[model samples]
Target: MRPDLRAHALHWHDKTRATQMEFGLWQVWEAGWVTAILRGASITILVGLVSMAAGLVIGIVCGLIKWARIFPLSLLVDAYTSLVRGVPELLIIYLLFFSSVEFVTKVVTAFGYAGVAESGYAFVIAVIAIGAISGAYSTEVVRGALGAIPNGHIEAARALGLSGGRIFRRIIAPQMLRIAVPGINNVWQTTIKDTALVSVVGLQELMRISFIGANSTRHPFIFYLIAAVVYLAITLVSQAGFDAIERLLRVRTRK
Candidate 1:
């Protein structure tokens, strides 16, 4: 064989070996590490679901404050929403993970509770970080939905002698939710993806487990690929669920 051809053959052989090695690693992962992957997946889902719910509550309150036209209160809520949304989600997670315990300690201390700082719960940190980031986006979504509600609806409610709270509860809140669902769905997906970032703080979330498996097995590509697939699966499932919800809401509204 020609020298060049021989060298080319050797190079291709080396590449093939690397590829096989990577594949072998993935095969091992598939064989036994599926449970760990599932555990991580559960954590990811829990964090996302909890954060989304907390975010919705925070967002709704902020959104209402914005709608209320109370200048100082509205400004405070606007500032909070802007600050949270403006910062990178990863940074927010990092700050929350590091400082949350201390902050909680101080609050507890102020209330005359001692030694609460020693109990640094990973789940709580993840929830707070995810919720804070999700709430920022939720606030805007809810605010836009509120704005989208027809002014005539409020006027009609007032014309019927409905009090402010009753008008909002009966007429405005439902419409706002209908309009907000699509936007909130986007935030929900974003929050799910954002949970991966929390893994950097030692959260045993899906990505973190993937990283551990990869490092332990010394097969970065294989484990990372699995992680990506899991994340994709999550996104797909969540998207389908949200679509169903949107459809249900639409039908209910139409009726």
Candidate 2:
């Protein structure tokens, strides 16, 4: 911790119950646990945001490929979406955590990075694992959003002799995004919650830290409740932001 940030944290901790209670509501939980939680919360946020970005990319590319109906690839995509959505999400996380280590180990060794394959690669794999499941659902949302666009609009673009790429760029893409915002927010919310599952892989995310604290303090309810409240706060703020964006889109549509 930097001098300034450490000082600020101490000042904040002093203002709270850290000094007032020898043992907090959770009798065995350590002092200054709030700082630990803040650290974990930041990791959770980073993982969530990065995984959401990966989901969006996967969704957009796969959704467009599915829309194009390209034979074997389309069928494969259908199977992937179905499999991912059908399985329990925790199973998916477990599978990825177990399976990815060896593959990542090989890659890390090839790149001459030692000891990274265990810890750092686990984080990368967690993002990919969470994003993969989120992407499956996102694919359907994006496809549905694109389907909402009228066929006549594309036909008219063709009638005017616009190229296929140009048609998408000038016509389909913008409307797809505006219509897909709600679905995007839904995926975002789901991804954030799903990040908690990554804790099982030893990700040191908010949920993982809370679970450790709970075990050590024997205050499962208190620790879990803190984690729950943090998740709620994050989701609430995300909802507000998405809703504001939706309103802006609506206003633009009206104009």
Compared with the true structure, what per-residue lDDT tens digits does model 2 show for residues 1-255? 999999999899887655444454645344666777788899899998988889889999889889888888899999999999999999988888787667767777888788543448768877888889889989998999999999999999999999999999988997898999999999999999989988887788899989888787666777788899999999999999999999998887788
Off by over 4 Å in 1: 1-15, 18-27, 100-120
Error of 2 at 236 (Å): 0.5
lDDT of each: 0.85, 0.86
Candidate 2 error regions (>4 Å): 1-22, 26-30, 102-118
Backbone clashes in model 2, listed as residue pairs: none
Can you give the lDDT of residue 83 in candidate 2? 97
Which candidate tops TM-score?
1
The window of 10 residues in a row where model 1 has the poorest summed lDDT is 113-122
- Give per-model TM-scores: 0.85, 0.83
